[model samples]
Target: MYKLFVAGALAAGALAAQLTQVSNYNNSAKAKPGMQDITFRRPWWVYVPDAVKSDALVVAIHSCQSSAQKYFQNSKIPWKQGSDRKGYVSVWPSSTTECWDVSSRASLSHDGGGDSNAIANMIKYAVGQYKIDPKKVYVTGGSSGGMMSNVMAATYPELISAVSLYSGVPAGCFVSASGASAAWNNSCSGGQSTATAQKWGDVVRNMYPGYNGTRPKMQFWHGSVDSTLSPNNYQEEVKQWTNVFEVSQTPTESKKDTPEKNYRTDDYGPNVEAIWAVGVGHSVPSHLDASEAWFGL
Candidate 1:
């Protein structure tokens, strides 16, 4: 009886160890910060599963007024749970101010000195340190972080494979905020920012001048009724990305109730995809499964 009891206790201990949670999520992944190039305001929270398989990196940026920890701990998406199951390394990058520096010209320009450059350098360090696959690096975010995701992909197209932006405006759409606080852009967020497809594409092309390389594919998500960032930005984002990929504005394929309930999707071949969460508000629903599938993880 004593022997049996001891063996059962040992097994329970082992199971508990295997079930240890990371970032307060129910998973066997581990979380750490200060890996490389991390500063006070520009903080980072990284999660690696117990047994990594993909060797791919996913940069998950947080929404405005949210921290990396909060985003990672989000119950809706469950970052650590997905990381543990998929075996992908995930990093959560926080903004220096109220939001990422997507409005500044420095952030908009490739290799320019700003939050974008710093984040790129962090990515380089992470890639080298983790032995990550250069071809599988992806970025995703919501709201302000979503906007920064566009900036990252635009500025470092060669470094990023794809982007999943939620409720984000198009790159350069809010450049009017340059030389001002990087926090808020009244015109852009208010749905007042407008430009022709060619003009919007020109903004992205100018970010990496003279580079004719392939631009990263874009996956966009937006709540149809998102007033905080204005649902109009979604159409503008589709226009920008479609032009960048040189695809027609007309979707090659369109589907309803895809990815999630009440969510419609429009695909422009392999270059651009947009998901519209109908009747939703400031934030959309869980995009975990769809985004992972989109990243091919």
Candidate 2:
């Protein structure tokens, strides 16, 4: 796999990153193994870049089996590469078991409402601890974490400014772990019927009943040769998000990324984009900086 690393990155070279240990949130009680306390469930970690802007924050979620700090540290396109000099604050909350509840109906409730709400409460914590810019908050992740990135944007469109994902299925591919297990075992085969896709789009809509607000911007980066999930999953995401953003099914624009790397982008609107990199597998594209460009970071 070809990894993408931008030149002149790491503005914070040799500057030790500060990671604060957070055990609770929302003024809620600490999380118990079986209890439903919302704050600090499973001992999450937070990293506020030195000289971070009061109002800019990015919540980076990790894939299943990866811890928050480790995933953030190892990301191909680490948000903190040079983001600290730009004053970007980042939060990495560990999922209780290194896996989020994104593959189910129950996952909908995991935002801002209770102590167990990982994404929402984390954002809330940012708003409380720092002067985070409401219009600049972002969420990005890989694999299952990527799925939750889409989920958080859909569920909390009002709070999240934009979302980016790599190698993830669309939201609502399955409503339970059993279904996810079955789908994963079967290579996520063919569940994306038109109806299935539309229903999944509704899962996003229902997040805000009777909502007539602006939908958050979306970006997707998928490897063309990914074998873990069906390639159809890409369209599953494109279909769901284009519907949410109210853009036409056909992209409004298309362009090649780099002639040498076989990268391309289908732009639906100023805020919606889908990227496909040829010869890449289930990992971040070598040109993920393109996604960051769209993020306007």
Candidate 3:
């Protein structure tokens, strides 16, 4: 009995240490714009309302020509869901050149030491410093930041709970700056097969080993009229995450309630969802109550 108790105590100690002592911290990942060694945000702004403590941390990345502060205010996330004690908190972190590298040889892999890993390091910082709940952590972004959000869901699936990607592309979509420009100009108007989707899913599954953990649920949005980004990319996002969650390739629930507005939704269980906001352009939706509801914030 004594031996069993000691073993249990040791196991608990190990878990505590693992949670408290986070590793692979990249200071550059949290740096501000215009620095010697690649910058993201300096002291990334954190929002915990009323000076209250927090239970969950929401990491939001800004698009091009935006900053952490701007994303927080303009992202339109429902922060009032907090019942008490600042039910939810948000951490806004900017990215380098307003784009997250998902295609380059450096960021597409598990140990690439790319911007994806750098962002993961940033999450570790918030989790450790704020003692936030890991299960409730989330990520969301718009445009270039949206692409990085997809990279995070793929490379750091074990770390984040769910992600809402808007106007983003699948992992390994663009390889270079010129390619990104072309994809933007052409809108990446292509479809991917289930096999291809599975291959892309493997990219995320390989990020962590021996991981029998719940995959992060995914949500996506794209404007049908968004010439900046093809709406077809939304389908690819859904397919990639559907493969990750091992759910049905076909959306179990598909609908467009507001035909006049031209908005439509395709939901593949809670693991993945895709929405097309009829005539909207390349931008984040002004009202994101659905995401807050999905997260139960």
lDDT of each: 0.78, 0.67, 0.64
Please write out the lDDT profile of model 3 over residues 1-297, one tens digit for every residue: 999999999987665411022233446543222222322323355655544455777777777777665665552644333323345666666555545555554454444556666677777777877788888888888887787788777767778988877787775555454423112323343323223778767766665445676777888888877766666777677667888788888889888753225778788987788877877878747345666656656
What is the per-residue lDDT of model 2 for residues 1-297, given as tens digits with 9 covering 90 to 100?
123233224544546567677765664523334433433344567777767654667777788788777776784746766456566777776776546766443354433332125567678777677777788787888887787787777766777888878787776564455623112323343434334446767877875567677767898888788876556778778888877776777989888864235888888988788888777877754244654565667
**Candidate 2 colliding pairs:** 25-39, 38-115, 38-116, 54-131, 55-131, 55-132, 55-133
Cα RMSD of predicted structure 3: 12.1
TM-scores for candidates 1 onward, in order: 0.86, 0.81, 0.73
Ordered from best to worst lDDT, the candidate numbers read 1, 2, 3
The residue ranges of model 2 lying beyond 4 angstroms of the native Cα positions read: 1-15, 27-42, 75-77, 110-116, 177-197, 258-260, 286-288
**How many clashing pairs per prediction, in order?**
0, 7, 1
Candidate 3's clash total is 1
Output the lDDT of residue 166, model 3. 77
What's the candidate order when arranged by decreasing TM-score? Answer: 1, 2, 3
Better of 1 and 2 by TM-score: 1
Number of the top TM-score candidate: 1
114, model 2: CA deviation in Å? 8.2
lDDT of 1 at 226: 91
The stretch of ten residues in a row with the least summed lDDT in candidate 3 is 16-25
lDDT of 2: 0.67
